[model samples]
Target: MDVCVCTPQEWDTIRSQRADALDASLESLGAQPVPPVFHTTAAPDPSPFGIQNDSDSERDPDDIPIFGEQLHAPSQSPTDTLRNITRSVRLNVNGVPRDRSTWKTLRDFVDERTIEDVLDTIESDRNALDDILARTSDYPESLSNTIAAIEGSVPAENTLPSMQDIFQAQGIASTDMASHLESLAAHFEQMSTALEHHEAGETFVHEDLHDWGTTWAEMNRDTEELPAILSEMEERLVSIDAAQWVPVLSQSRELSNVNRHSTKLVATKRTAQQNLDAHRRILDDLDELGEIMSEMLERQQAVEDEAREHVALLHHHIVTIEDLQHRFTSYQYAYSKLLLELARRRQYRDASDRIVNGMIAQLNAMTEGTFSSPQSQASTHEPEHGQYLPEDVCLFVQNAPTRWNVVPHNQELEVLPEIDSDLLDDARLRVGTGVAALGASQSL
Candidate 1:
């Protein structure tokens, strides 16, 4: 059975028709009639209402046909009888209209057409919605396959050497990927929808979309008209008991603030933890480096001490050579003086030999004895082969002491005290003095 309900536009049309008929009846009876209006005129709703103009016909808004159009009274279409029209002319003028304030939000007020329209919209975008839904349909299979592939291709146990958390990597789950794809598809669909709506010449006003929430909340009811509906709503909002909700709202706000701060603090804690870990690792490396440097320093110190000892030995050798050179110079001077004295003594010995020879010749003439001087006999004097023979005197004469000192630059010069001849033994010197005295006496 086909059933339909009248819309507000159809109701208004019926009311206007009734008012006109009532006005006509009162004029014929010669009585003043109420103005032919039930409510103030307003712009008509644009939504279709399944009714057309019947120019010469009269209808009533409150009159309803139940079950079907078969019950409608087709015989009273015109009502040409003046008696019947006059009898019904006394209508209530101050009758209260239907309460339409709940028409938008009440569940019983919405018509079937609005539900059909919503269903139609859903049907219109079915393909796009299907495409979005299809993305996640394979989630279970895909996730299982991904896990299987990972298990097959990659070992679960870490194969690489341990990094000790020195590095990090990020991974996405199959479900996450599917969800991301779904979101992207939804975004594309929304963009396509918006573009299509824009191209269809629809205005971008909030009023066009705001009516859906009202239409959706409503169920079944005739829309009502009121002179001060908007004003009553304003008063309701202004007179709300705000004192009852202030603490709840404040607590919610405080909770939100605490949550925001807690999130920030958690992030700070994570960042600080990362910093501490990195610093600890760096500190470990630095400590190890410090230990290595300390060991190197100790080894270097040992080498330096050894080098200093070697330098000291070399310096001592250099000083001993210099002292030996000074003594050698003094011996050379003494040896030259000894050679001079030897030459002088040899000349004196020759003169003494001549005098002794003369005395011997005279004694031999007197006593007729054979006497010969020592020089007239064979000498057989072997050459001196001892330390007295200085090594290569010609080498000292030919070469000037070009590098007598072998001291290096920056090396300290060692000073030795002057040698005191009194420190020598007198016995070693007296033999040399006695030999010289005997030679002197023989010469005299």
Candidate 2:
């Protein structure tokens, strides 16, 4: 087969030297380091349930005795009275209380030495439920084998350049495609002179539509002062709902749903300003300049939808003046906590009426005329002998007589009642004039 005819640049330099020797044998087999597949297999016979035994005439398939020959009910020893009546008929079929002496005292208190401390507390609660099910099954299989070993270590197809490296990158992009089409035709003639100066600045009007028609005539004179500022905030919320110490605020159905959404946003901003002044008088009698630029873009989209409904009716009149200033600051904090609980219950009823008038002037200075009325002490003088005696027989006849008719101070004296000190200086001048009128009513 000696008829050779290579040519196309010697088949593009033998296909770029066999694609650079197959990219240097795939970069030396990707820097060669994969060696860990050690799957040794012989250790599985520690069979708890994996039954095997094959000798002694092939018998031990886990000693094959499961329900062997099936006729079962015979072994009954533990002091069997028919094994305590078949364990009280299996503790009444398991709902337990068949009380054969309380299950023979809990089967002699669990026999195998307390059932190895209840199988060591059920083998420490089954090794804490098998360590919470082996950390919920080994943390999602070790986060899905570390995201499948990071998407199987990434390299799927990238390095394939051969046909003489795409014919020398297509002869360096056809020698820079005619200086990139003459710098893309001088960037398309500077984007056609910036789109003919943006079509001569779109032929005119936009000073933001004459500052949005002088901000829509100053938002229609501020929406005609929003009905006198919502009628002076509904007359200061009707004088704070006729104030008697103000608490009412069930916001009158949120101020009548904010005055029916500000009268339906002032009738939808006067029907979007009469459809933007009838599309600016049909764009000033359109002489057909494309119907006056489509009626000035429908009057600038109806003045931006009536300035977004007058900024949502001035944010619903600033949230109804911040909910009537938080209900006038909760009605001046409930009328200053009801005037400080009525000046603390009028200074606790004037200190309990000056401590009940100094305890009625010390009980009228110790029972003043020793409780008189025996017809005013027999019209003032006679019952005096043992002045009605019994005050422990006048202190045992003034301290010594056992009872010689117990007559102590025979009786006409009555004097000693001075110390009222003007009822303790008028109860310390009415408690210093109620603490200086509660410190001048708390400095007003």
Candidate 3:
């Protein structure tokens, strides 16, 4: 019959060694050796505005300007020009009045002097005139033309016009200038209010454009970094896929099954231990009964030598025999129960053996012939090959039968020495002639 060959200690040792080896191999497979650390000097910073400082040949081939001169050029539309003019006027007089002293200079010069007097004054002070003209040249052509007309109107007599004429001219010119300045101031105020409203309207638009540019820059940065981020994510996914998840899950399931089996085995062991204790108690009772029976037999023999106590002794012997019969019946019942328990234990053992054999087969399959079966170890100790028993089989000797005997036939029986005539007669009186003769023949 097949049986487990390895002792508990041997199995534990084997499993521990295999487990250690597996751990080492897994460590080798999972370990990522530290790469050599190389010290690198920092690279130069890129230009803040994204424009490369490199020469034309060294510049990135992919870099291209997004904005050209045309994108920043002023608009040609009359409406756009009007808007620009209004914005400029508003900016120039943001915190001051449109009719302030700075603007009164033109009206004052025209009011205080005639066309001729202003020319003589400018010619007499040419250096100051040069400075004023130099600063005033930026004004409109109309203003310049008015200045030239005043210079040409200068009298050849080099004398001022009459006070009466000057006053009349000043009154007319000042009234005209004041009227024009008032109109201009009113127009400036209207344009300034309109520009303020227009600028308010454009505020959100400008902010939106700024935000869009910022978003575009952020998107560009993210696009540049996308490849490395994707690569890292892909590597992590691959590592997850490459992990021994299936094997680990399978092992976990197997361990759970083992635990369940171990629980059942523990219950079985408890039952076996109880039965063993019961057997020990029965054996102790049997031993005590045997001693009692020996003493009773000695008392019966002692009484057989006393004729006066023969009747009482006979009565006592009969009672002792009945008690002995009852004890024997109890022993028989206990032995039957023990035998039944032994049968159940043998069945359990057989199931365990089957389980172990299946595991061994699985182990062999998994290892792909790298590991040998225990049966191979059992075959090395045939009587023809060696005197020593197989190690695995020897381990079983402590619990298994050492030797077996077959029942012999009449012809195979050996002759025995003759029994005494008196003893033969006494056995015949107790067992009857036919049984005595059968026993005698069997002995012979």
The TM-score, computed over Cα atoms with residue i paired to residue i, of candidate 2 is 0.19
Instruction: For each of the candidates, give the backbone clash count.
Output: 9, 0, 0
Lowest lDDT sum, 10 consecutive residues, model 2, at 32-41
> Can you give the TM-score per candidate against the true fold?
0.20, 0.19, 0.14
**Which candidate gets the maximum TM-score versus the true structure?**
1
Q: On TM-score, who's better, 1 or 2? A: 1
| RMSD score of candidate 1 (Å) | 71.4
Q: Write the per-residue lDDT of candidate 2 for residues 1-444, one digit (tens) a residue.
A: 122233323433543543343334234323321111100112221211222334677674323221112123323342333333333334343322423232221112112343234335434543443443343344446456655654554434333324465445445544554454464465456446546866887542446435433333544565565566445434444323233211342333344333222344456566667666765655544344456456656755665554444434333333332332233233223323433444466566567667767776666654454543344544444346656655554342332212112122653222111112332343344354445433432332
Candidate 3 lDDT for residue 392:
61
lDDT of 1 by residue, 1-444 (tens): 112134324433543543343333223222211111111112121111212333335654322211112222223423332233232233322322233332221111113353345335434443343444344456557556655653454323323322232111101222343454465465456556656888999875566445533221221111131224323332332222223322533443232222222344456566667666766766665576567657656755665554445444333333332332232233323433443444456566566667767766665664432223322221211133324456654333323222122333465322111111321222235335545533432332
lDDT of 3 by residue, 1-444 (tens): 122244334533543543343333224322311101100002211111112244688766533221111213334453543343334434333322333233211112111133234334423443432343344344346445544654444433323235465345435544554454465465456446546766888553546535544343554465565566545433332223223222432333332222222344456566667666766766665576567657655654554434224333323323332332233232223323333444456566567667767776675565445324344433533434445555565564233222222333642322111222342343334334334433432332
Question: Model 1 segments beyond 4 Å from truth?
Answer: 1-271, 301-316, 350-444
Full-model lDDT for every candidate: 0.36, 0.39, 0.38
| Candidate numbers, best TM-score first, in rank order | 1, 2, 3
Worst lDDT 10-window in candidate 1: 32-41
Q: How accurate is candidate 1 locally (lDDT)?
A: 0.36
